[model samples]
Target: DETALGTLHSNRSAAYFAIADYANAIQDADECIRLRPKWAKGYFRKAAALVQQQRLKEGVTAYERGLVFEPTNAAMKAARDDTILLQKVKYVPYPTSVMAPAKE
Candidate 1:
């Protein structure tokens, strides 16, 4: 039951992240992690939110923490590596929205 709830929250966090709502994503992800501390997806969601918020250092920390819980997780490892590379390269994150002229 807890796992299912955690997964549901994780999914919601991902949706929030997709919509560029990093704050809410982080909040939902935190609740997900609290619901199921051992579930790696929560940490991944949290890390993704932090990264999207431009909190690169914090994101890397969260990702690494998730790796400790799931050393064999390829997705987590890949995301961590990508985040690290982006940090190293000083990657400029793109704006979450694109604006166009309003139609009359």
Candidate 2:
């Protein structure tokens, strides 16, 4: 029952964050975390809320914490990389060696 309630709250919090409702998102994320401390997605939800509220620094930090919890999550990896890139560039980007073979 408690776990189910936590999931509902956490999912709704993610929805709220998606629509820029940081306060409510944070509220629900907080509840979710309180209810399920091992849930990685809950932290990610909280990070999204912090991001939407214009607290970029703390938001990325929270995302990093999420990575600690979900190290192999591809979406989180991309988001983390993109956030770092966003901090560095609007137009210019550091060069990266392409992984695939270059065909003429």
The prediction achieving the highest lDDT against the true structure is 1
User: Candidate 2 lDDT, tens digit per residue, 1-104?
Assistant: 87998899999998887787899998998899788777778878887787667666666786787788789988877776776666556446545656556889
lDDT of each: 0.91, 0.79
Per-model TM values vs. the true structure: 0.82, 0.72
For model 1, the superposed segments whose C-alpha errors exceed 4 Å read 91-104
For model 2, the run of ten residues with the poorest summed lDDT:
90-99
Where does model 2 exceed 4 Å of error?
89-104
Least accurate stretch of 10 residues (summed lDDT) in model 1?
93-102
Predicted structure 2: lDDT: 0.79
What does the lDDT come to for candidate 1? 0.91
Task: TM-score for candidate 1, please give it.
Answer: 0.82
